[model samples]
Target: MAFSKLELFHSLILVLSVVSVQALTWTTTPFNPPAIPLAVRSPYLSAWLAQGAGAALNDVWPTFWTGSVVGWAGFVKVDGKAYSFLGAPNVPGAAFTKATQKSSQFTSTQSIFVLSAGPIDLTITFISPVEPTDLVKQSTPFAYMAVSAASTDGSPHSVQVYSDISAEWVSGDNSLTANWSTTTGNVLTHQVQLATQAVFTENNDHIQYGSAFYSTTNTVGATYQTGADVTVRAQFINNGRLPNTQDTNFRAVSNNWPVFGLAHDLGSVTSSTAPVVFSVGHLRDPAIKYIVAGGATQARSSYFWSQFSSPAALITSFLGDYANALSRARAFDSKVNIDASKISADYASVVALSIRQAMGATEITISKNSDGSFNKNDIIMFMKEISSDGNVNTVDVIFPAWPVLLYTNPALGKYLLEGLFRYQATGQYPNKWSVHDLGSSYPNALGHNDGRDEAMPVEESGNMIIMALSYAQKTGDNSHLTQYSALLDQWTQFLIEDSLIPANQISTDYFAGSLANQTNLAIKGIIGIKAMSQIAQRLGDTSKSANYSSIAASYVSQWQTLAASSSGKHVTLSYGNSASWGLTYNLYADKLLKLNLFPASVYEMQTAWYKTVAQPFGIPLDTRHTYTKSDWEIWTAGIVTDTATRDLFISSVKKWASDGLSTQPFGDWYETTNGQPEGFRARPVVGGHLALLVL
Candidate 1:
């Protein structure tokens, strides 16, 4: 719709009135992501900032991670002139140009957005209660959505801002019947619960079947819902008039939008200063909590409410450490940015934006034992990148995901391995030599998804051995490896025997169909054996280490001979096939493990040959197809130390990240000829983008 002249005129006046130095403190960047992460807190309770051509905050929506609408809208009343500042909603005379939205900074634990609203400024912060060392907080589902306001006009203005949450948060749709209750604590609270209390009814990324609470906190006013939307109204009046206050803060069930909102009744502000924080949270029931957190849900739930408001406090203690948080996050971002800047700006943006999603993709939880003590049994699973399979804890997914965790904290790296180790210890997987695709589909993470046809048999065993050795090298502790030492020995021996020259088994790139004597698969097994030898050395088994080391060295020499043909510039996709070539990306593992098993000629030949096969989006997964996995391309790019070649691969990823046709977060698989998403959006394998950091 065209903007009316008077509406545009009023918007100009409002912007001109804003004179505070604190307005728009965040720096702007050239690349704007499809969505900015907001409450990137946990598995079920995460949100993102939406942007449009107008670039106004009001016109944008706060969508769930899956790009579903959470039914949230925000409005502010300035001296009785109501205006929409958040979410897309129709209001008479409120059609001002959207405010500029910016994310000043972000980390795995926190993200901040500032909106330059017409006459006032609003700061929105999303923080997970993560302390790096505290697994409990990292696993906790409670997140803080804190909003504060200040007068940018340098004149007193009565500002009341509120956000209405949609009922879809309860059952992935607003059509579900909802009952609302009003709780009058120190802060005004509206809580929505589904009349039907079914939980975990389905296992998928879409929030289609679970029930949860949708609440907005703050203000005192009548809370009710119209047939169209669940609504909560908090009015801030000027010049001695106040909005009507309801008698009993507690009320009965009514079908509304299942909405809750907070009222920031700022009487008036003349100078530029940070106002009090008004916040809200999304809480779920206790059954699923016990499954993941166990016995600790009661305390965590109580803490979630206490964080909203207290004497002289309106935000979580996390907000109190804002300065420290920003400083640390900036430092972390700067280090990544420094190297990222080494590449072209296009590639730099992809790395910066993609890394955050990688960090947020895994769902973690700490469990309490039967003895009433807490154990950091974090069951970290990377969601299959929009594969629609909803495969949980896939071995190949974990392989690409470990680089990012290893960079941040090796403990988190171990977190991924412990789950697999636990599964093997149960003997739940019948295969004595290999494992299944996933423990189970997402959310139904009970045991291996035994029903699906198996892929990545030899692929998974090799991945686990390398993972255990890589983690041990970083942390210098292999006790976890020792617990599953029998499994490791069995797997490594399998690689030694059949995996070297084996039957056509499904590999990581199973989508391309099974290839016989796949050269890349050989690279994986070679590294796996080398890693086991390294582990043996660390475990003080010098004789075992020496024997395995000699075997791996002999295999490496044979690999060079078997993989190459007796012709000019040989580039074969598999051993002796001579049809096409795939990347020996796994060869980087030699240097990563500090083992000089491979010759320099190996990397030089592959890196030089990769250029001949480059396509628009990236080099294909192999020469067999035009579709590509972005993560493997990055690993292949790591084959050389040259800056220019690495940027070539990363620039392709930049195109993939901003592809208009794709959804939120990112996709690992895409068409190489053009930047269209093929599959795998919002998966943890994007963590492989951080591969360069470890190198």
Candidate 2:
């Protein structure tokens, strides 16, 4: 059916109406909303400063000391009552530094550091004190360089500072410089790149990555107070890399630099015993080192803001502009596989709707082919980074959206397919299925390294194959499928043979502990096989297509025989007779990841089960946990044809999105009920946030 502007506008209104009503409303102390930087759109854009893991929005405080350090925590204020809690932990000084390092179970860690302090003491700060602006920003004094390395000249060979921002690098006694760049509209980018540096060192010059939040009570004239409800937590980089344990050697002096004109000589002391000193030395070897942080750095933010922010804003600035751009995009090549109307809506809706989630994440570029023919292919999505220098290719991170791109822009869909297919085609893996991820988050695509327990190979392969076919179907083009035939065949072969799928193995949903009889895994396998057959048939390979088609049809029979439930819902866990199969089973069965195998009645039953499992924020993935997968909930919503059911799922997504603006940026996953973002922001999974448009 040809979609008219009226029809498109109607869908837009429906999405906006449901979202505006169901989403949580956090009024600034004076009932005004926070000042959201118009540029960013991601999971974090929703609720600006609420740090609770659940959706209970509370006030936070940014504790800036007059000395060389700052801290943040949660604060609650009632008419006659007052409360304070450590809302988030950025750099926690232990007993080794705090009380007794032995008594701590630092399951979580994050940090922000100052790489090169200016002549004056440098300060960094954040806020969330329930003011007109959800998160308030400030500057705090630069403090302790927790980890450092020295050189022969007593310069900073390398150093690691634990402050509001993180930095690791090797510096000589030479002049330390800062890099500052900016663009209008992106407030997040404005703060990140202001007074930032771009020195590439292994340890000392690297920026530390963590979450920074604070609170405030707004006064009448756009002024706010340093309130009690602020908090800051440092996020540690757990990229599976081996940890280092070396004593720090900080830079002690600079003979020629003016900043050292009258510098005090505190001497070469290891502990924080010195009053103050100028330290300079390479922290570690300058050759082939990674001064890693938890997030994006200045340069990275600039690149992303230029590419994503400007274009997004142009679309939203005017309705005619949006329609014209969409028309131009479609006119660029009629052969593009997605519907123009759908893409238009997606572009419009994401900005109007999901802008907050997009802003809180990071974006980076990778070099693929030297000629740059595939420049678009090199655009990598970096989740939340400790600083602005992080990349976005991680394993379990692929869980965001299978169809988000399919609905918005087919080119993006092509980009996703190219990334996955290119990784698998690199001959990096021996198995027929693909590996978990290309590498750690926020860097280049290092070869897959999750090893055996890292990724559900079969699960990802099936997902890729199915998604490819869906893209082809939506675009009405069989070119992409035809081009990647060999890879698809290999994946299908793996499914039929090795994918008996051990009970204890990991599935794409990494957090769900290993399950023996994972019905969802079985469903994914069935759908994948069918997709492959369809792809083969479209490519005109009848015999090969029929071979897989026959297998898939037979598997369907077996699946029905094995997965049927007595209660009319899909069967729960396959093996654990004692396992409680709740909404996830049916949602997987009925909604999410359109295998196109189930009939309408079957989907109806599945949606019914989801209704039973529905929590305030969303439908639960299973009875095992109340927290839900936000993207998956939207994916599941795609299965039903009923407008009400679709609206329900869309409303749930808006609820999470509303929380996202103020929370964290475009997280891959989050807690279901309270809408707290879980792990990995700006990761690729947020692509799933676009699932509804495809429907």
Query: Each prediction's TM-score against the native?
Result: 0.81, 0.53
Query: Model 1 off-target regions past 4 Å?
Result: 1-30, 50-56, 91-114, 127-131, 148-153, 180-182, 186-190, 203-256, 275-348, 371-373, 376-388, 449-453, 565-570, 659-661
- What lDDT would each prediction earn against the true structure? 0.60, 0.38
Candidate 2 lDDT tens digits, 1-695: 89753345346545644554345332211011112121122212212232222222112322111011112222211111222222233223211111100110000010111111211111111111111111110001011112221222333221121212211111221234322121222111111111223332212212222111211111111111111111111111111111211112222212111110001112232322211111111111111111122221222221222232342232222222223323342342232223322434323233222322332332223332444222433433334322222433333343344444454445444544555566566565556676655444333344443344265766777767776777777677776687778888888887786443434567756576777666667767767777788888788888988888788778766666555676656556553343455433223422343445655666676666665555656666766677666566666666654655555665555555544333343343556667665554434454555555555
Model 1 vs. true fold: TM: 0.81
